[model samples]
Target: MPVVGIIAEYNPLHNGHAHHLEHVRKLAADEGIVCVLSSNFVQRGEPALLSKWARTEMALAAGADLVLELPSAFACSSAEYFASGAVSILNSLGIIDCLSFGSEEGDIDVLKTAADILAFEDDDFREILKSELDKGLSFAVSRQNALKTVLTGKSGQNIEKAAEAIDQPNNILGIEYIKAIKRFNSNIEPVTIMRKGQGYKSLDRTSPFSSATAIRHHIRELPDLRAISNDPFLKSNMPEACLNILIKETESGRHPIFPEYYSDIILHSFRNMPAENIASLPYMEEGLENRLKRAAIESVSVDEMVSKVVTSRYPASRIKRIMFSMLTGMTAEFLDELKSNGYAQYIRVLGFNDTGRSLLSQMRKKASLPIIVKPAGYKKLDTLAKKLFEHEIRSTDAYVLGYRSPGQRIGGQEYTSSPIISVR
Candidate 1:
């Protein structure tokens, strides 16, 4: 059977996600849905509202056939790196025929055109990009502005409104996904499903197809299960099965992890870290670490610390990634190694169903990298792979520190946790 792949955070599986999966299933036409999900931390540089295992169970319940992990290093990265890591894992499986994603444009051809332009980065585009960056625009804004200018016609207007799509968060990520696929020269075809509901950043529930941001806002406000079940808006936006998972996780003290939960730990990590060590962090540059180190010592809370550390050059997400890097002891050397290697060394399975088990069998036959099903197998990996896998473990251990229940803060949970399997 053919395999269709998707890359997602599934932070708390909502109606929009369920809709996407249904579309993937119909588009695949009997092919299996293989999802590469973020673990513990997400691209936004925050702990997932639910743990990876809980989120995996939610995906299986929502009709995904298989779920593999996008390792912590990549999971907590920016869009380009995050997409590259996810697409790399799916490609290494050697069986995925297509990669499907939600897009505001819902036009694969248009996304591909933009992706090719970005992937190639011709001389004219490069000059414009450098000019925008020099103006102190964030990388995302710089790229979008450059593209808008480059695609403009002789009349000084954007051609066919090509630049508008890149302004949306989903379309930006969708373009990156396509660019990553092309960068690897992978054969996986690109597919897009028009996104529904409010934008990704919108916190207001506009319809049953609410954004995850809106769902998360609801989760933060209504901590009681009875209240959550009674809230008509949330109930309509989230699937019943997914809601139960969130409730069970919250009740069990394994969920609703907020960045504030680790404020003390992060502040401590930064204050205690040696000044020289800051130079070794991924994306560290121009004495940025010095500003962060000073901020950590002066600020009393994580929120204050972030506000102090954020600058024109360093966005909030970048600051959070730096905090995570320090918390996990991730070094510049390790990031260099990853860049040189270009992909993960193993496929880490998060969950599966009966059909997924069959897909796993095919992966075993066709995969080019090691497939990790148990913690004991870490010893069999190469040196870099083992080191990278250990980083994931450390990240998870830090993730547990944010747990509301003291008992749930126990470390090494990644080693003991088993893949979430759906009963037939």
Candidate 2:
């Protein structure tokens, strides 16, 4: 059977997500839908509202055939690395016929054109990018300026349109996804579904399809998850099945995992860590580690530390990634090695139904990398793969500390827990 791949956090599956999955089912027809999901920690470098397994169950219930884990190293990195990692995994699967994503700009041609310009940056583009960067503007702003300058006369009005498309959050990720496809030279066709409801960062709950940020914010505002059952806001915004799972996880003391829960550990870790070591983590550059060290010593919370260190050049997201890297012992050298070894070293099964079982069977024979269905598979991996898997283990151990229940905070769940096998 054909397979359509989606890369997402699903942080907690909302109605918008269910809508997207329903569309994918129609678009794929008889094909299986494979979702590459972020782990407990998401792209923003925060612990997911619910554990990965809970999210996996949500995805399976929402129409996904299979769900796979995006390694922690790439899951918490910047857009480029995140997209690259997810796309690489799909490419390695050898059965994905299309890669589908939600974007503010639903036009594939626009995203592809922008992706082409970025994927194959010429000398002129680089020089312009450097000049813009030297002006003290943020990287995102600088790249937009650089692209506008480079595509000035070549594309005419298309330049303005492409530039606008690049400015939106989802469009930026969509472009990166297309760029990664080009980088991998994969055959998977790109498909874009126009995003519905509020913007990615909007916390507005007026709409039925509220943003994940809004949903999470609403959930956090609750005195406890006990209110979730009667919360009309959640009832309208999330699918019944997903909301039920969230409710179950909440009652079990496993819901609403937040970054602040790990603040003390992060602060303690940073205080004990040397500046030189912090400098070695991914995204650390040009004495930023020193600033972070000072922030760690001065601030009482992760939010305060981030506020102190974040700047136009080093945005809050970047700071969080650096902090998370330190907490999980992720280094630039290790990530570089993984990149050199082709981004993904193995396919980690997170959840699957019968359709997914068949897909996994096909992957076992055709996938470029080893297919890992259980922890025992770790021992069979190569050296680099072993190291990467260890990083995931460390990340999970650190992540569980954020759980409300003391019993749920136990480490090594990676070895004990199995993928959610949905019986449908």
- Which candidate leads in lDDT? 2
Residue-by-residue lDDT tens digits, candidate 1, 1-424:
4579999998778898999998888876666899999988988878888899999989999989999999988888888888999998999999999999999998887787778789889999999999998997778889998998887773422344457788888988899999999999999998998997778888877689878888888777775745765678877988999888877887786677888888898888889888888778876777887898999999988889989978776789888887887777677788768868976779999999888998999999999889999887888999989999999989999999989889999999888988888975
* Model 1 misplacement above 4 A: 154-159, 223-226
Q: Encode model 2's per-residue lDDT on 1-424: one tens digit a residue.
A: 4579999999889988898999899977666999999987889978888888999999999999999999899999989999999999999998999998899988898888889899999999999999998987778889988987877777556566787898899999999999999999999999999998899999998999999999999988888679999999999999999999988998998667889898999998888897888889998788888899889999999999999998888889989998888888899999999889889999999999998998899998899999899888999999999999999999999898888989988999989989999998
TM-score of 1: 0.95
Clashing pairs in 2: none
The deviation in Å at residue 179 for candidate 1 is 0.6
lDDT of each: 0.86, 0.90
Once model 2 is optimally superposed onto the true structure by TM-score, how far is the C-alpha of residue 4 displaced, in angstroms?
0.6
TM-score on alpha carbons, each prediction: 0.95, 0.98
Query: How many collisions per candidate?
Result: 1, 0
